[model samples]
Target: MNTAPRRPVQLYRALLAAYPREFRGEYGAAMQQLFVDQYRRARTPGERTALWLRTLADTAMAAISEWLKAWRTAPPAARLVRAAGILFIIGGIFVPLAWWLGTLRPSFDYPYRYQPFVQDVLAPALFMAALTAFTGGAICLLLGMWPAANGHQRLALLSSALGSTASIVGWGALGLQLGDSWWSFAMGGLTLFFLGVLWAGLAADARNPLPHAPGAWVLAGLWIPVSALAGAVYEMVTGRWLDGPDWVFGLALMLTSLGMLWVGRGLAQMPVQAARAQDGGDA
Candidate 1:
């Protein structure tokens, strides 16, 4: 065999493929050069490994940034959008369907007399709403994943908006069963979560700065406990909280949860933006 040695330049060049194509196009050669320069300066394999790891971190950040930018900028094909729609539907259905199944089980009265709709229509309706929300959400998320799927991502966002709206409506209707009012702990939580998903989906395409709003933290902190507390309040005002006639208090508490979701959307966006910024800097 020839006595030639492998080149570090070649090694690092091969590693650049791990990055997204747009990123590679923008900075691949420069990164490879940096790797070569660092490798030339390092004396030990340990040092080389450390440098390579750092370079990899930088590359990953760049890839993620490129991915996000592409998600916002690209216009995806029709097929990709359709597939995303399917995934959203599947995920959405799982949520409400699971809840309905639990309700339908022989544990408690299925609210057949007081809330006839729960036993008959609402359960199926919720399940379908969940399916639609998820279908749309998934489409948005997947569309954001690839450059070719940009258009699909926008479509997915639209679907998510629709899904989120429908989810709010569904929660409102569910609240009515608990009371004539549209508020409950469960509904509140569901609404918040839906809003989070909707915002996450929207931000993917909007390129909005990650939500740094103070409201995000407040909502994140208060959403769950406040919901639970509403039950106590209901008990104090009325006799019981769990299965009561006046669900209006519960609805109020649940409505508060929407604030939490709105805030959470902001909180979630920050880290994503920071990560992208770091990646762009490295690239």
Candidate 2:
């Protein structure tokens, strides 16, 4: 009776442990025995190595499939929160698109230099979409904070709310040709504050993956304050608000949009258990 190689069998059994606990408890021994039998029946070392590689690949694929299944079957609240995060990402993307389009006019003038199509059509549409998107995102995020709300979640909620309100006020001010008025200043200030709060919360959360992505949210967060300060200083010195080049403003908008997209993607990808932990639940 030829016995299976002890080392290879042991390794195979160890790999089986990667499966879910319930699955391992039920079928682990049977699976190990089957693998050992196959190992003993192999004709050569090459065959055994091939079997081991196949098993590893299958195990990895199975693990990913199980995780996707779990996400699909997660509770309704978890799904809603993830959906809200997606909305945030979409809304964030629109911010830059609107700004870029508005700046593509013939002149780089202060506030009213936009082409007719940009001012009459795209601007209003984008602003309305932003208002709707942020408002919906805020409501969903707030609802997702049911049982226990962490500081980060609360900050996200507040930021979304402020963003929604600012969009509404901004749209109205634009309609009344008050783009450079105090209302405009107030909207800009509110937007900066919201971005700061959101970035702080995201940075503090260790589970979020935004830090790993290109153009991390930290840089985006820092850019806003720095740009605002620089713009202010320029205004004071030059005795004009729009003295800076147009590309600088465009760059700032791009950074803000990218940062929000990264944060939203991170939030959407967070596991249900981790999200619950944000509300004081077991991770």
Candidate 3:
């Protein structure tokens, strides 16, 4: 009777991609050997199939384990701290929105009696909406940490979806208030376009681990500063500031940098893990 190797080793190697870098590096050869030994011992075809199934399942579990710890590639306590920071920024946006919706409601409703479109209504509303968008986007940006730490991709997607929706809604509300002035219209158009782009790119493809996505954290980090700096430059040029807090611009910059640092740290881990995985596979 012919008794040759029945199972293909390549299938097992392919499945190993699901395992964590460290686990695969240290125990992959040993595990592969064990699998080969078991395969050789199997008396029936059913036993071989069951063994392959188990191997795949174990590899899948290992992948999940590594994904959960992905945030360790980031800063210490990065998830908790970033979440809190985002919450505070969201609160800041609410403050101005509350103030305007309370103090300026009448002026906004009956614009004929006051400065009408520019000072009394649209400007404040647009400014408030922009800040609200910033807050929403920032919180969504922080969702990356949660997903990385806990393997909560669903939660991450939901958070990012909400944030992206808020930004788009807020931008649209503000866009409608802009008058016929070319510059104002252009600015509103640009803001709306950007909101749409983010919605399409990040919000739409939340499920896929697109390499370009950088998750929400990096996007938010890049977004907040650009928004703040743009707003600041606009304020300086137009002789106006958002909510009378010029310092907030600097704060936005600082927080944005911190977010970037977190993301950068995460990216740095990829190479190390890849190297380890390669070395382990070779062994």
Pick the lDDT winner: 2
Candidate 1 residue lDDT tens string, 1-283? 1211257666667777665455677788676666666677778889888987887788778767765675564333322333343444354335435354435644366444645566446665665555455445444444433332245444544544454555566555764575545554344444444444444444443433224454543433344345556765788898886553434533433444344344433322323323343234321
TM-score of structure candidate 1 = 0.28
lDDT of 2 by residue, 134-215 (tens): 5676667666644345566566556656665665676667677875564555457445544643554554445432224534
For candidate 3, write residues 5-52 as lDDT tens digits.
644666776677565445578788887777777777877989878977
Candidate 2 yields a Cα-based lDDT of 0.64
* Superior candidate under lDDT, 1 versus 2: 2
Q: Candidate 2 at residue 186, lDDT? A: 48
Better of 1 and 2 by TM-score: 2
All models: lDDT? 0.49, 0.64, 0.48
The alpha-carbon deviation from the true structure for residue 258 of candidate 2, after best TM-score superposition, in angstroms, is 1.7
| Segments of candidate 1 deviating more than 4 angstroms | 1-11, 76-283
Compute the lDDT of residue 266 as modeled in candidate 1. Answer: 33
Ranking of all predicted structures according to lDDT, beginning with the best and ending with the worst:
2, 1, 3
